[model samples]
Target: MGEEMNKDVTIDTPYITLGQLLKEEAVVGTGGQAKWYLREHTVSVNSEPDDRRGRKLYDGDTVQVPEVGTFTIRSK
Candidate 1:
C-alpha cells in the first residue's frame, strides 16, 4: 500500500479537541461520526491510544490515524 498523506492543521487557540480536529480535517462527516469513529477505530496521540473525543491536542502534538494519515497540531 502507498504511504498515508501528511496534513498540518493550525489552530488559533492553545489547543483543540480530538473530535474537533477530526471534523475539521473532514475525517468524519459530523460530530456523531467522529464519536463513532473514535469508538470503532484506534487513534494514536503521540503514539498512544487515544479514545477520548475531548482529548486536548496542543501545539506540536501528533495524531496518527492508521487509515487516514497523520495530523500535526500547530498554533497560529
Candidate 2:
C-alpha cells in the first residue's frame, strides 16, 4: 500500500470490534456483512492474521486489509 493508504481511526471507547471498525471505515456496507467480508478478505491485526468479527481493537492496534488500506486505531 501507498502512503495515502495509511489511515488513523479514532475511538472514544476502550476498544472497538473488528466488525464495527470495518463499518466505520466503510469497508463493509453493513455491520452484518463483516462476517462474510472477513471470510473473503485477509485482515491482519498487529501483523497477525485475524478473522474474528468480534475481535477487540484497542488504541495503537494496527489493522491491514489488502487492497483496502492500513488502519491504525487511535484513542480520542
Candidate 3:
C-alpha cells in the first residue's frame, strides 16, 4: 500500500484525548467506541504504540493509525 498522508488536527485546548481525536476526525461514531476501536486497531503516538483512550495529545504530536491515516496535532 502507499504511504499514508498526514492530516493536521487543530485544537484550541492544551491537549486532546485520543478518544476525542478519533471522534473529531470521524474515525469512530462515538467516544464510547474508542475502547473497542483501540482494541481492534493499532494506534501510535509519536511512533510509540499507545492504546489508551485518554492519551493526551499536544501540539506537534503525531498519531498514526495504519488502517486509517496519520494525524498531526496543531494548536490554534
Candidate 4:
C-alpha cells in the first residue's frame, strides 16, 4: 500500500488528546477506534512510543502511525 500523506493539524485548545487528534484527522473513524488502534498498534510521539489515549499533544508535537501518516500539531 502507498503511504498516507503527512499532515499538519491545527488546534485551538491549549492541547489535544492523542485520541482526539486521530479522530479529528480522520485517521480513525471514531473515538473508540482511535483507542483500539492505540492499543493494537505502535504510535510514536516525538519519536517515542506513546499508547495513552488521553496523552496531551500540544503545539509542535509530532505524532506518527506507520499505517496512517505523520501529524504535526500547530497552534491556531
Q: Whole-model Cα lDDT per candidate?
A: 0.93, 0.94, 0.93, 0.91
Clashing pairs in 1: none
For candidate 4, the C-alpha RMSD (Å) to the true structure equals 1.0
Return the clash pairs for model 2, or none: none
The sequence of per-residue lDDT tens digits that candidate 2 reaches over residues 1-76 is: 5443889999999999999999999999887899999999989999999999999999999999888889999999
- Backbone Cα, N, C clashes tallied per candidate: 0, 0, 0, 0
Clashes of 2: 0
lDDT over C-alpha atoms for residue 75 of model 1 = 93
Q: Which residue pairs clash within candidate 4?
A: none
**TM-score of every candidate relative to the true structure:** 0.93, 0.92, 0.91, 0.92
Which lDDT tens digits does candidate 3 get at residues 1-76? 7776779999999999999999998889998898899998889999999999999999999999886899999999
Query: What TM-score does candidate 4 reach?
Result: 0.92
Worst 10 residues of 2 by lDDT: 1-10
Error of 1 at 28 (Å): 0.5
Rank by TM-score (best first):
1, 2, 4, 3
